[model samples]
Target chain A: MNQIAETLASEHIHRDEVGAKIGMWLFLFTELILFGGMFLAYAVYRFSYRDYFALASKELDVFIGLINTLILLTSSLTMAMSITALRRGNKKLSLIFLSSTIIFALLFLVNKYFEWSAKFNHGLFPGSNDLLSLPRGEIIYFGLYYVMTGLHAVHVIIGMIILLFMLFYIKSNKVNQDYYIMLENSGLYWHLVDIIWIFLFPLFYLIH
Target chain B: MEHKNNHIVGYGTYIFVWLTLVTLTALTVTVASFDLGGFSIVVALIIASVKALLVMLIFMHLKFDDKIFRIFVAVAFLTLMIFIVLTFSDYSFIR
Candidate 1:
């Protein structure tokens, strides 16, 4: 009877890995809808105010936007490689790649800070007198700009935090080769951040 | 318990996908520079979609993951598309 009880206890502690992954995917679906709504709004404004959007987009520095895109893309690669490394039981390489991913996230945020600061110095922010004096289309353009990119920046920070925790988990063996659903989930979140920026970069900076 | 069949993606594959994504980014920027007018946004979006797909399938492991995940994501994206189309249809005609 004791042996049977022990077996049952072991089974109880065994996780449903597939279920965990499905749950993460469900959460990601919701995130998609959240950002999808904003994309719809942006499309409406851009369609209605084509000329103003074009003019407003010109004010954006595409060079900076391009650089940020590359940063995020490279970060996504590192994040993926980290997961692969972990799966292959190469903890050291996984940690290295994960740390690089976090560094890239920081670099992306730093660039964003400078970009926003430059706009602020120009008084192009939402509700600024300079922005208020602009045409309605331009005003809405910058409004969407702030709301979309601002929200995206928030996600970047969140992704960084998630990856930071993942780094520790990997080191602690809580997320080893045999148990890495958590790390994979984090990778999914990070990739989603990159995917969002892929669209955002073109919509805001390259549309002109 | 770990699934014994868990497909492991190689580092080389990740690097290849990364290279493709970077190249596409450059392509989009170059395409945007030509001032294609209304068509420019369309072209840019198409390129961005390709890049996003590469990340989803390769980086996110969707390609090796269970079929259910692929179906779920497809449904989610379809729903978003429907919402966008319905909204645009309403706005496009009124203006």
Candidate 2:
């Protein structure tokens, strides 16, 4: 009887969809607060060395930052559209949108690469001689800049991998209208990355 | 108890929000070029908040999802704000 019961438990069993969402949101809360601590550190340091921060922030390339902002925002739109497409039973369109989202993610990373390389060429790294000789505030500014943006870029990479898996899932018909939480959760994570960049952009690159 | 919600957002709405976000990005860049004294950071942060709200509400589908989802998001932001305010007290007093 026990063996029969084990066999009866199929993968199509009733799953608590709502509970899954709640759990995702709860995990997101922890992620949000984790970044909150970094923002707090940024605030304290910026407050302490207002002049140094102004000078250091001006060295950042707003143009590249602007481009990446648009890329991420557009990716968010594409990711959202992918969800809608999948739900509408158009796997082709869903995969296309997911591909676009991943491409945008790559574009953002490429821009970041050039941005960081330029800073490296100029010796703006945290403990480099140029930065070391600068005011403590400027050093702290670059330090925070590297740490925050580095961590955010890591999130972008993770998000892209998740979307890639999502694309495979959609192609396999494993994600349908009746069971698309995987897609939805990935969308949530992507948007969170975009939102964090939305705040990070103006704070680091825009404020003159 | 498998539950699925398919909130079909109009293509037009996503395009509209996209346009608005791009416009706001332009506005923030333009505003930063001007010297707003102490109000500069405040303005930038406000615009950032608005953009974040749009992504959360529409893109993330929190607007159409369960109200509890929204409530939890609200609580998270509120908790962050409380921490901010508490830190403000420390900074204000010490500095």
Candidate 3:
């Protein structure tokens, strides 16, 4: 009878772990909705002023955008490799790949900063700018551009911080081969960031 | 913790994604050089959707996840689409 009772208690723990995973997935769903709203707005505006949006997109630096895309794709690859390493119990390899992923993310942000500053210098900012001297609809186009990409950048920063936390968790042995829920979740979030950029690249930089 | 990385489909999907992205990028640039009129936005968005699907299915591992989670994501997207369509209708009907 006592053995039966102990078994039930351990079963409860496993159930709780699965429940926690579901909760995390639900939170991630909410984030998807949030980003989804922005994307919807972008689609509507782009549809309304197709010509103006395309012209505005041409003003963007495609080379910089392409470089950022490559950087993000590389980071995603590293992130996936990190997760694989964790599952394989290769703690050292996991940490190394995780660190590289973080570094690539920072490189992406730096490139974004330069691209944004150049846009500002060229008077292509939202609201009041020389770029707005075109049709009134183009003004709204740039507005969506800044808002969507800016929000994505904010996410990248948040993702970087999460990666930092995961890094520490690994160092303290809280995350290991037997248990790497944090690492897996962080990788999912990182991939979400990359996914957003995948859309943003075409919408903002290649608006054909 | 001894799982094997035997998901060949996932890796193959990533390769396909890279190729598609490159092709679509080039296609968009080429299309932009011409005068596609209003159809350009539609074409661009369709290409973007293809890219999004590849990333979501492969990189995010959504293809092999629980069915309930997949339903949740689908519902969220449907809700967002409904909201956008309603708002756009209002905007179009006003004035």
Global lDDT of each candidate = 0.91, 0.90, 0.77
Q: Flag clash pairs in model 3.
A: none
Instruction: Write candidate 2's Cα lDDT for B6-65 as tens digits.
Output: 568977888899999999999999999999987999999999999999999899888888
DockQ in order: 0.82, 0.81, 0.39
* Backbone clash total, candidate 3: 0
For candidate 2, write residues A8-102 as lDDT tens digits. 64454756778888888898889899999999999988888888899989899999999999999999999999988887878899899999999
- Model 2: pairs clashing at backbone N, Cα or C within 3 Å: none
Among all candidates shown, the one with the greatest DockQ: 1
Ten-residue region with minimum lDDT total, candidate 2 chain A: A2-11
Write down the lDDT that model 1 would get. 0.91
**What digit string (tens of lDDT, one per residue) describes model 1 on residues A21-44?**
889889988889999999999999
By TM-score rank, best first, the candidates go 1, 2, 3
TM-score of 2: 0.94
For candidate 1, the docking band is high
Worst 10-residue lDDT window for candidate 3 chain A reads A13-22
Candidate 2: Cα lDDT at B24:
95
Better of 2 and 3 by lDDT: 2
